[model samples]
Structures are given as structure tokens and as C-alpha cells.
Target: MSVQDYTSRLSDPASRKMGTFSYLPEMTKDQIRKQVEWVVKHGWNPAIEHTEPQFAMSNYWYMWKLPMFGEIDVDAIIAELDACHAANPGNHVRFVGYNNFTQSQGANMVVYRGIPV
Candidate 1:
């Protein structure tokens, strides 16, 4: 499905993968760690982003923090992911691996969905 269609399905409370690995299933923590490691090895920065459930269609996801570059600590990235999820528990959160070698192109994966708490 298209990104718009997949995003619209978020209201159905389903998770969707985007950018790289869109053809594969949702990744496990180990898989994520490997991917992050590869991104860092390639000198790409890691970034987190989220969009409020109400604004899922706005296509205006907010950045959780500044992109992390030169940081190879996977645990730290995971921690930031957890913190972002806690703060926006009802939104859609994603982990983005940005490659500066190419402008405006990166690997994105939806990694969190806040259930009502």
C-alpha cells in the first residue's frame, strides 16, 4: 500500500513500515539494532520522529530530538526511542536513519504506537 494508505490505516491501530525494509515484516529489537549499527557505520545520523494520532494525515511529523550523529551507542538510541514513546504515548513514532550523502533520502521505520493509558 501507499504511504498515505498505510498511514490512514494507523487509525485502525495498525503499524506500518516505511522507507527501507518496507517490503519486510516489522523488525525485532535485534534487527533494529543491526540496522542502526549499519547506519552508523555508514556515517548516517539517527533521528526520531512522531505524529499525533489526530494529525496523522498532516504529514507533519515532529522530531523528538536533534539527529544523533557520531553516536554509536545503540542503547542510547533505544533509550531515546522509549522516552519519545512515553512522552507521545498516543502518537505514531518512527526511527529514521538519515544519510547525509544523499539529501532528503533516508530509511524510516514506524517503531511505536501509543495505546491508551
Candidate 2:
């Protein structure tokens, strides 16, 4: 499915569901591994840690934060951000692509939530 479809699906309140990354790119592997490792080491149950992987999750630098966690499929990650944008259409959505000239492939789609009240 296209990112738009994923984004649309994310808005359905019922669509907030669990999911995982199909694969982590070499550049992101270490960080992703650490997040997973935290779950394993602290004995945090997967069911509890990654409460909602399917949609509207944030792409925090370190990963593993609740109501949402894990690396997630890039497609799914982008979709979640898109969903957030959809929910607040008037607000301009911006992003810092994975790798800027100076950055090390830290590409991500970050959607700052909400419109001005």
C-alpha cells in the first residue's frame, strides 16, 4: 500500500495497532537493536512496550517509548506522520530528511502535532 493509504488508515481511531519493522537498514541497525535489547534486558514484555506500532507513532531518536515504540517499517513510520498531518491539515508539516549533508543518514519523517488553537 502507498503511504497515503497507510496515512489514511492511521486516522481511524480503531486503526492504532501493533507492528514491527520488516528490516532495519545498516545505518539504523545499532539503535534499533538497542531498543529491542532494552525490552529484552529489562524484561519488558513486547505486548506492553510497543503498545501501538501500526499508526501515528513518533520517531524519537533513541526509540522505545510507550503507546508507541520500536523502529517500525519505514513505510509505516511515514504513514504515522502523515496521519498526524492529516489530523491537523491547516498546520504546515515539515521534516529533516534521513541524511543531511552533515548528518549520518538519520533520516526520519517527524510530524509535529496540532494546529494553532
Candidate 3:
């Protein structure tokens, strides 16, 4: 079956408890910056990941690039996010805040969603 067909048959929920403010509406740019700042202040590294539209419902996602640890600059992070979005305009992009103390646990938030044509 085509990936689109498989995706169409999936029944994922509209909302997921992924990030700190995920229970609320999708955050604005300012809000996102605040969250990123908080994460950086707490010594967490930020990372970006995305999945193409065809695999939006899949558990697997491709990393946009390496994690941005030790980089407290929010603009740089946002720039990377924008770059990723520009590169994959038809994909679902998300931000991940990785905590070293957690070993393998991290907070995730969807940052950009490309509308299907």
C-alpha cells in the first residue's frame, strides 16, 4: 500500500501530551522562545526532528540535524528550525528538549506543521 494510504487509515488522536504547554494551544513565537529559554536555563539541549507527510502517523521520525546543546542562543535555534521547515515544507517538524539527567527522556513539542496540498 502507498504511504499515504497507510497514513489515511491511521487513527491518531488530535492532541498529545508532549510538551510543557502542549495541553494548551500551539504556542506563538514568543511563547516558544520563552519555553526554549527555560529549557536552556535548566541545562537542557534542544533538538529538531521531522517526519514527511506520508509518515506523519509513524512512530519513526528523521532528525533534522544534531542536537543543540551548550547553545543558549534562542535565535540560532529558531533559525535552525526555520531552515528545517524551508527544507521540508511538506513535513511535520518538532522541537525536543533533552535533559542530560534524564538519560533518555526529553520533552517534545510540535513547532511547525505543513498543510497537505
Candidate 4:
């Protein structure tokens, strides 16, 4: 086949195009809890963000609020995600782990996929 066809075969346009965990299947609530738990175990601060599906691959996303400092409860984090999703039902919701020491992102994954507007 042609190079364009070969490349297209290797890439899935249907997949979620977020920063991390994009290659994996859509994460369930339990999986999200596990990921948040890992973030807490690593002492990484948690944050939430959202964006329109069309902007999912964009570099910038609207932060739900300030990065949650010293957040240890996974349920609270999930609740914040829920709140953001409730407010922006038409936007994709994601959870992120921020490393204060590194001043960079540790991990991020899309937890909820929004309906296309």
C-alpha cells in the first residue's frame, strides 16, 4: 500500500487524543479511582480540566479550578471531576497529576467523554 495508507492504518482517528492514556481504552470509574490513588501515593497534586471534543488534542484546556494541593482523598477528586462534568456536559473531562517538585505534569487521562456539540 501507499505511505499515506500505511500511516493511516497505524493511527486510529477514532481514539481519544489526550496527552496520556489516550492509547488505552476508555477508563472506568474504578480505573480512575486507581489512577487517582496512584497519584496520591506519589504525592502528586491533582487537578481537573475540560475542553470541547474538537479541542481535545489542543495544547490548552480550561482548568476546572486551581490544582488541588495536598489532596489525598480519591473520592473528593472524583467528586470535583463530577462537578466539572456536570457543569460542562458538552465538554470532555480529564484528571491530571501534577508534580510540584518537577513543575510539570506527571500523568493525565480522560475520564469522561462529552457528547459532541
Q: Could you say which candidate leads in lDDT?
A: 4
Computed on alpha carbons, the lDDT of every model, listed in order, comes to: 0.74, 0.35, 0.75, 0.83
- Candidate 4: give the clashing pairs: none
After superposition, the stretches of candidate 3 with alpha carbons farther than 4 Å from their true spots are: 1-23
Sort by TM-score, best first: what order? 4, 3, 1, 2
Q: Per-residue lDDT of 21-63 in model 3, one digit per residue for the tens?
A: 5456778999888877877888888999988655656568899
lDDT of 1 by residue, 34-59 (tens): 87777777777899999875565557
**Model 2 misplacement above 4 A:** 1-67, 94-117
Better of 3 and 4 by lDDT: 4
Candidate 4: lDDT of 6?
Answer: 22
Please state the error at residue 103 of candidate 2 in Å.
18
How far does residue 51 in candidate 4 sit from its true spot (Å)?
0.6
Candidate 4 regions off by >4 Å?
1-16
The most accurate candidate by TM-score is 4
List model 4 lDDT by residue over 1-117, tens digit each.
Answer: 654222222135344455547556778888889999999999999999998876666458999999999999888999999999999998889889999789898888889887643
TM-score: which is higher, 1 or 3? 3
TM-score per prediction, in order, is 0.73, 0.25, 0.76, 0.81
- Residues 13-63, candidate 2, lDDT per residue (tens digit)? 443322323122222534544543443344332211111232235542323
Candidates arranged by lDDT, highest first:
4, 3, 1, 2
lDDT value for model 4: 0.83
